[model samples]
Target: MILTADVLENAFVRLEPFEPSMRAEVRSALDCDPDSWGGMVAAAYGPHFDGWWTAAMAAMCAGSRIPWAVRRQSDGAVIGTTSLYEIRPEHRRCEVGSTFYRPETRGGPVNPACKRLLLDHAFAAGAVRVEIITDTLNPASQAAIRKLGARDEGVLARHKITWTGRIRDTAQFAILDLDWPKVRQLLDDRIAGFSES
Candidate 1:
């Protein structure tokens, strides 16, 4: 079973469970600047968003995924989406992926803040491992994951079929239950830095 989609929030961001009401807000955020999703799966932006949303909704209803709409606290606008997919309750693992943000918020506190909340929730939900993977071509994504203190687990060649119909290699990273202490501190420091600036 997937973890419950409880509201997760911090000073910078709030992750709310996805629902039909968020469609317009999320669509508007993603449609603002197409470039923000350049390295991500093509469907995440542009004309394919509708199809992607449909599939995601189906997954949520199937109990295999929990989706969240990331929102900024200052204005309470949806900025992007993220999810816990491939959830395996028996194995106590899940993938904290399918994440994206608006271009202006890319290098700010939102990502780390969201990650901290998600990680905390996952571990607290009895997850022993939380995996995050990115397209191999996305160095920025790889770097961000590293900063979260997750260890690299190498690449998976031809792991996914992108929206553009290309076979893509994926870079895998993971954080085990044992690594949470240090990782949590790393995240706390990062969030503090954001608040300072």
Candidate 2:
């Protein structure tokens, strides 16, 4: 499917096109949890965010990724960013990663809602496979991926070094198009339950 920096929204959160104008709000919101990126590649503070934003925009410009500023729907506050990257239309596959949320928004409804939107869009775009990978050391993320109904595809040893110079073992997970029906139902049920609570 054709991917663009289109605004994507569900009941709980809104994914707006990432723009330079959104820097301050996003940075401010991310400041709510300064160490949020500890498990990931980018830093959330100081000039590091600028570097991350630049690379993100570059990927968008090159049509390799579509990034969004994740905003809480209830209050329209920027919460974090998520993207569909490594888009391979011919292969009908893409990766969902580079996601970060404000600390307070973690362990809540935001992530499930966002993933629902991204997965829905990816499959609609003719994706046969959608991947979600995390550092092997991150149990929280591993659990989240499992909850998405993605089958464990094992790990890639010495995947990539983080910004902190830590060698990471990447835990790979994926949901195939054939599995979408069941996985979508699970995510839908989770979002509904989350919305209720």
Q: Evaluated with TM-score, which candidate comes out highest?
A: 2
Give the TM-scores of the predictions, in the order they appear.
0.95, 0.95
Model 1 score (lDDT):
0.87
lDDT of 1 by residue, 154-182 (tens): 99998988766778899999999999999
Task: Score candidate 2 by lDDT.
Answer: 0.88
lDDT of 2 by residue, 1-197 (tens): 67666789999999987888998987776565556576686676665777888888999999899988899999998988889999988888999998888777889999999999999989988899999999998899999999989999999999888889888899999999999999999999999998788
For candidate 1, the per-residue lDDT at 157 reads 90
How does residue 2 of candidate 1 score in lDDT?
41
* Candidate 1: clashing pairs of residues: none
Clashes (N, CA, C under 3 Å) per candidate: 0, 1
RMSD of each: 1.5, 1.3
Residue 19 in candidate 2, Cα distance off native in Å: 1.6
Residue 186 lDDT, candidate 1, scale 0-100: 95
